[model samples]
Target: LLVLGVPPAFALGTNKFAASCASFTSSLTFIKYRVYDGDLLKYLVFGTLLGAILGVKTVLLLDSSQLRIIIIILMMFVAIYTLFVKNIGNENKFEGVNKKTIAIGFIVSIVLGFYDGFFGPGTGSFYIFLFLTLLNYDFKISAGNGKILNFVSNITSLIMFALHGKILYSIAIPMALAMILGARLGTKLAIKNGARLIRPILISVTLLYAVKMIFDITNH
Candidate 1:
């Protein structure tokens, strides 16, 4: 949006709003189909709420240049690690949710949820990665649980942006509707391709975003 002359703040807020709306809707489907673990989602909400509050303040405090640089550095690391680490999300070895697992989930939920409110470019990707590494969930289940956590963090962040009067309803509402429609197709394809689809998409998007961040830095 900035490339096309949309105000940067408005773009960020609108995108966050639309994505939150879409994520909320898609999360319901995941719950309906039993793709997500209800037990884990409980702690995710708590961690995400606290993290989102901190994140909203962080983004509001930092200048765009500083924020972009931080985001680029973090995303670059994620992209590299994901590419080099092979066969990480291949299997589901979920040893039933325990206090240990929930503890780690809380830490990461705060971190990733902070990321969501601060920028939100790779919220889902990070959630999926964290769940896979932390809980030993396969691509399918990780993606499902990721949606649930992402939705909560997104809503939390959206409320913050809304409170600040940043949301652009004209842009957000339409994008949200389109995103909801696309969610149907996205879920269907996930079912059809399974890990084959999720793994590559995650890696590819992470890398592409990293590259884009580099470009953004250089251009700016």
Candidate 2:
């Protein structure tokens, strides 16, 4: 949608939010109880809600250029870690996450949500990585669940933006359709290839978005 010249609010309002929900629902229906965990899903949903509310406030005051630099640095760190950080989640051994970690996850989700609402870049990939590295969720599950929670945050932000009259409905509808199609394809690819493929894509997208932000900042 951004590549297509649709505005940010419209992009989220129409495309990403709807696509996320559709993909999540479809995945659940297709996979059934094999992978869906209700407790983990609740945490994700809560994170999304918290993030959306924070997003509303953050968009008004955050500096885009500063954010760009920060995200670039963060992505660089993640990329480097991915290269050398063997046993990133080995400490936990796939055990259920602790309460402290869950709390931290909630906080991180809110912070990221605010960033997403304000900047609208690499939000999905960020969530996936956070879950993978911090919470020890496998990359595939993280990506799948990330979509579910991200949809929640996107929808909340969209509603807030729409209520404030920021969304351009004309662009939103078509862009949304495009997003839905894109997300479907993306999700299928993620499912087929599993975590190894998803990790590289996440890094690539984050780096690209980081570079775009840097370019925008420099141009401004």
Candidate 3:
């Protein structure tokens, strides 16, 4: 949308709207598959919602250029690290809910939720990475849980945008329809293929976003 000349605020609102639709659909699919960590969702969603509210409130007040650069660097590091760690996300090592795991979930979700509400790029990917790293989930389950949390954050941000009258309903509605279908198909594929499919895609997405950020910064 930005490349197409839409204003940043409008693009952010529209993106949140469409993403809310997609992530909601994906979350339902993941639930149907029983792939998500139900025990931890409460912690994740609560922190995410709280952080999203704070982030939305502060979005316009912050200078995010430095943050974007840090995010790009982090994304690049994640991509490279994942590329070298062949078995990292291929096996699930989660040992059920524990105090330490719960704390990590809440903290990471809050931070990424803030990032999602503030700038909104690569939040899902970051969630997936944290799930894999901290929760010991395989790629497929990580993606499932990540999408669920991302849905919560997206809806929270969408509500804020809607309240502020930033959303373009005409564009967002049609885009949401397409997003729902695309999310359904993509999620089905991920479920079917598991880590073999998801790992490379995660790495690719992280690298692509990093490069896109670099491009945006250089262009600006």
Candidate 4:
């Protein structure tokens, strides 16, 4: 959408809002299949809601150049670490959510959700990583609950976008229909294949988004 000459904020906002319905659908599927962790979700969803509410104000105040730079730096690290590190996110390991994990989830969910609302790219991937490392969840479970939290943030932020009249329905509607099908396929694969499917895709998308953002920065 950005490549199509849409303004950055509108493009991001419209995409997030459009895809939100699909995300919600995916989250429900994850929950219906009994793979989702409701206990973990309580912490994540609460934090994301608060963070997303603040995120609208934060992004509206920040300069676009600064926002791009922050996203670039963050994704640069995510790409490098995930791509280079072998055996990370490769297997399903179960460690119950401890105090440390709960604390970290509370922290990162806010930070990540703020980013989700303020700047949308890579939000899902960020959630996956945060869950794997902090919440002691395996890759598949991370993805399941991540979709739910992502949807919550999206809903909170979408309301703000709608109130401000920032969404382009013509663009958003078509994109949304496509997203619903895509999200359904993605959730199915995540449930069946787990980390093997998610790892490479996550790394690739993160790298691609990072590189594109850097390119946009230089051109600007």
Candidate 5:
């Protein structure tokens, strides 16, 4: 949409609108398969709700260039770390949410949700990483849980976008239909392929997005 001449705000709003619809369907799929971790969701959803609300408000006040740079740095760290850790997300070690995991979940979820609302890229990658490292989940479970959190944040932000009249309904509706089909298929594949499929895709997408952000920052 950006390349197709949509304004940045409207592109983001429309993308969020479409993604929110897709993520809702994806979340339901994950839940039906029982692939997601329910123990951590309560905390993650709560933190994401608050953080997304705060983030949308903050984006109105602050220049996001600085935040982009910071996110780039964090993305690089996550990518590099995941690349070296071969067995990181291969197995599920999450026994159940405890005090320590709960604290970590709230902290990471709030920060990532804020990033999602403010900048709107690589949010799923961040969530997957946290679920793997902090919450002890496998790639399939991580992706499943990540979608749920992503949906919460996306919907929260989408509401803000709609209220501001930034979304293009015609474009968003068609794209949303496509996204639903794509997201459902992707979720099924992720469940079937597990870590082998998810790890490389996650790494590749994060690196590509980082590079794109770098180019965008330099050009701007």
Candidate 6:
């Protein structure tokens, strides 16, 4: 009955569904490691599924333009920080995760997972930033861990959309393969180059994507 509560007009049509699935699959290509790790993956899967249910309901009522604006602003902030801030001697800043950081991670995970389910663009970037800044994870490690969480969120969202008949399998299958390939390449790069390399790529991608979103918002 929850599905029925959503207006039929808001249901994802064939084209939009296909686009979303393709986008999801394409995103998977950038990570180098396995998508999930032990219990954390399991928890992320559960969390993402739960978040998706709520996200679908909320997203249908949200203003896409406004969301785009918010995302662009976030990207700008990340770009500024990356460009000006120095990571020089702070390598040991996040050597260990503390209780507060864990709490923050959980909260951010849920919130970001909801957003990912609702509308994904810079989900991976957000995950990486949260880990690096708040949790003190170095760039490469954060990217590795981000992939795990991102994969869980993507899979869960995909499942939810599939159940609701909002996914286009034809697009999803091929796109997923592409994403997996991209993820492998991205992961390898991150591992080989370490934090120094990952930082620049992250900044570049975030800013470029943000600019694209801003253009989209303005054009619409």
TM-score (all chains, Cα) for each model:
0.91, 0.80, 0.95, 0.90, 0.93, 0.76
Clash totals for all models, in order?
0, 0, 0, 0, 0, 8
Task: Report the C-alpha lDDT of model 3 over 64-174, residue by residue, as the tens digit.
Answer: 556888899899988888889888988899978889999999999899888888888889889989999888999989999999999999999999988988788889999
Candidate 4 lDDT, 41-151, residue by residue in tens: 686778898898788777766744567777777777777777777677666574656776677878887987788888877898888877776556777887887888889
Tell me the tens digit of each residue's lDDT in model 2 across 1-220: 5567765555555554554455555455324424333466667567768777777656644544356677888877776675577545222234565687668677777777777677666777777778777778776667766666666777777777767676666755665677666766776777777756776787678777777777766765
Candidate 2 accuracy as lDDT: 0.65
Candidate 4 vs. true structure, TM-score: 0.90
| Decoy 1 TM-score against native | 0.91
Stretches off by above 4 angstroms in model 1 are: none
Candidate 5, residues 1-220: lDDT per residue as tens digits? 7768887677878999999999999999999999898877877798998888787777656655577787788788888988999999999888688898888889988988888878778999999998999888899999998999999999999998889888999999999999999999988888889999999988988899899999988876
Off by over 4 Å in 4: 2-5, 91-94
Instruction: Rank candidates, lDDT, best first.
Output: 3, 5, 1, 4, 2, 6
TM-score of 6: 0.76
Deviation in angstroms for 214 in model 6?
1.4
Model 6 worst lDDT window (10 residues):
7-16
Model 1: per-residue Cα lDDT at residue 155: 88
Encode model 1's per-residue lDDT on 1-220: one tens digit a residue.
Answer: 6676776666777888889878887787777778877887787788888887788778877755466667666666766766777877778888887898888888988998888777778888888888887788888888888898888888888888888888889889999999988887787677567688987788788878878878988997
lDDT of each: 0.81, 0.65, 0.89, 0.80, 0.87, 0.61
Better of 1 and 3 by TM-score: 3
Off by over 4 Å in 6: 1-49, 61-63, 88-92, 95-97
Q: Is candidate 1 or candidate 6 better by TM-score?
A: 1
Residue 151's lDDT in candidate 5: 96
The TM-score, computed over Cα atoms with residue i paired to residue i, of candidate 5 is 0.93
